[model samples]
Target chain A: MPDAHPPTRREVDVRGPRFAAWLTSAVLAVALLTGSGVLVAVQAAVFAVGALAGLRYAPYGVLFRVLVAPRLGPVREREPEAPPRFAQLVGLVFAVVGAAGYLAGAPLIGAVATGLALVAALLNAATGLCLGCELYLTVRRARPARTA
Target chain B: MLGGALALTALAAWWQRRRDGAVRGADDARGRTTTAVLEGLGVRPGEADLTVVQFSTAFCGPCRATRARLQQLQATRPGLAHLDVDAESHLDAVRELDVRRTPTLFYLDRAGTLLGRSSGAPRPDELTALVEAHVPAPGAREGRDV
Candidate 1:
């Protein structure tokens, strides 16, 4: 039987996602340190935009495509889009939870959520470790097989 | 707190890389699988000299790299077959094979006997060497030359 959700064949510039991760890491760090509800909300909005609109339309993605990629010369390889898109969804989950926590006056909850997201973002930015992609794979493997 | 997170992230990266792309021999007991399991993965018995059964997920970055490398090897090496199984769609095989991660590759001989396994994207040189070790030279067969 054919797989319903096959790995995407369409390639994307890997740098774009890493650049977005750098931005996300900075924003999440600020949100965690300052305990600012507004910052958390803003980060959440960024996550939402990235998750829904994809890297092409996301702010940092545009920045990478326009400014960074050209200076780096041609990339030898382009990665599939699914992994980074899944990572964006993971970021969205943390951002939404962090925003809610901040709005409810629970700074600790907000800090923890944002801190977790920051850790993941920093890992991607520094080491190219896509923890969210790993989580997505784990979840997919754990789920029961679908019956046609 | 931020410093601790950084340390943890570094540790995680180190650990992931240490194990990433390393191929090891499969345990004889655990690696044994019937032809039925191979059939489930759409591989016919004796179809090729060696079959690379790669279990992958849709959202795995390493899986893509693994696939590209394996396909490249398959293209150049005769009697090498590459089968990519989506773990999401083949949960039973995943469980039976005890695949805990994406891009887990099961190396099987022509008779469907499991030889080894690799959990992440294997290095191209290492992969080539491993395949060469398992597959006999062209025109060499069973202590007789064709």
Candidate 2:
């Protein structure tokens, strides 16, 4: 199928960093809700403050384009998706994992996993290599098609 | 950057794991260490007298079924084998083969010659006929797909 839209970049799309702050917010929120003691909550608060500080500085995309994406690795071809959708997805996974962990009394692990997922979601937003996208592609590719 | 690396690596690991879980049927993807599809199969082009290369996707259930079926077909048909390559990874190969759908089957004679192809789940009769026609009951024939 034809590309849904024409891509504009150096064979790689450099996305804005609104995603970074969003991820930090998501992770902090999960950590706070899942953590055991007051100290952990304080750490979450510190992260939130840091997130706010970063968000204030020319938005997150500036950080991503200037600092993050560069050090990650070379760009590769990837399909585009609505950016906010990815952020929301990251948030949702973290939230769900956090909740499940709390229920299972393994809140720390769940929260951490959720935080990790958020991190991945955020990175993918900037770099366009999210696990979800890869999963979708791998699943789609594995499923055989039949065309005459 | 560190966070991004972790994220990407986790995704890659998950991808590898998912592929690992796949059985040895259509586009197995598991144990496919090499990026090259043929090398992943642990087979060389010169080893088989006839080869059929199929470009496929992960979500195509029909492709999975076809792969399994093809695996069975290969057991009885010596000198014949198949390779399933991820079309996304090999865009050029897809274009070169003129594949338009998942599980697009490209056939080759014993000499590694591109003999024929089909765009869908081919019938057993069709595969057998193609093999019979191309190989022609053995003159110790040519090689196939690399």
Candidate 3:
């Protein structure tokens, strides 16, 4: 056999995802601390945009590409899009749940949801430890094997 | 609450980094034979004196780095083969190997016995040492170095 699998999709600057994670951490922190429905909704919208449009078009990603990336010079390494994209979907899940919790008059649920996302984002931003990416791998491992 | 989250994040990062790229010997208890598994993956036992089998997923960033480093090592080292397996498509092997993370690597000897396993991207020095310990010097194994 030639190989088990084909090459993955195009690579991305690893810094872009880290920058977005920093932004997500900040937004989630504010939402969780204030227990403000508006802030939660705004954070949820950010997650929605990222999950739906991908990091390339997301506001934070664009900011990184235009501002941060230029200052950092060329990156020697790039990573696959699947992990970070999966992370965005995970963020979307928590953000949407938090938004719904806040809108439904249950501040505790919103706080918990936002708090979980905040930890994941902070871990990625501060130390490059992506919990969401780990989760994505775990989910793949749990799924049934596909025909090779 | 924010302080707690920050502290927790720090702790998690510390723990993750501590174990991230470190290589350790495999457990003797788990001593599961991998010859059949290697055959299933199209790698016949004794095909190479030593093989570095890396289990990776599409979304894993460290897996890419590991692949590059291992391939580089293979270029200079004879009797050493590098095999990359997509963990997503090979769930049975993943389960058999008890791999919970991406970029998990299994080192195999000539007879396909699992020697050591490393999770995450291993440091270049560590990988070099591991390869050197298993694979003989370039000129020793004829026709094995390609």
TM-score of each: 0.88, 0.34, 0.90
C-alpha lDDT of residue A116 in model 3:
83
Clashes of each: 0, 22, 0
Badly placed stretches (over 4 Å) of model 3 are A144-148, B27-29, B140-143
How do the residues A34-124 of candidate 1 rate in per-residue lDDT, one tens digit apiece?
7877887887787777779876777778888888999997987788877887788898898888888888988778778877888889988
Q: What is candidate 3's lDDT per residue for A48-139, written digit by digit as tens?
A: 77778876777788889898998997997688877787788888888888888888999888878878889999988888766877777677
Residues A29-95, candidate 2: write the lDDT tens digits.
4445546333334333433333343322333444666777788776552322232333334444545
All candidates: interface RMSD: 2.7, 10.8, 2.1
Fnat (0 to 1) per candidate:
0.49, 0.02, 0.65
Best prediction by DockQ: 3
Better of 1 and 3 by lDDT: 3
- Sort the candidates on TM-score, descending order: 3, 1, 2
Of the two candidates 2 and 3, the one with more favorable DockQ, higher being better, is 3
Candidate 2 true-interface contact recovery = 0.02
Better of 1 and 3 by TM-score: 3
Off by over 4 Å in 1: A1-10, B34-36, B137-146
For model 1, give the TM-score of chain B.
0.84
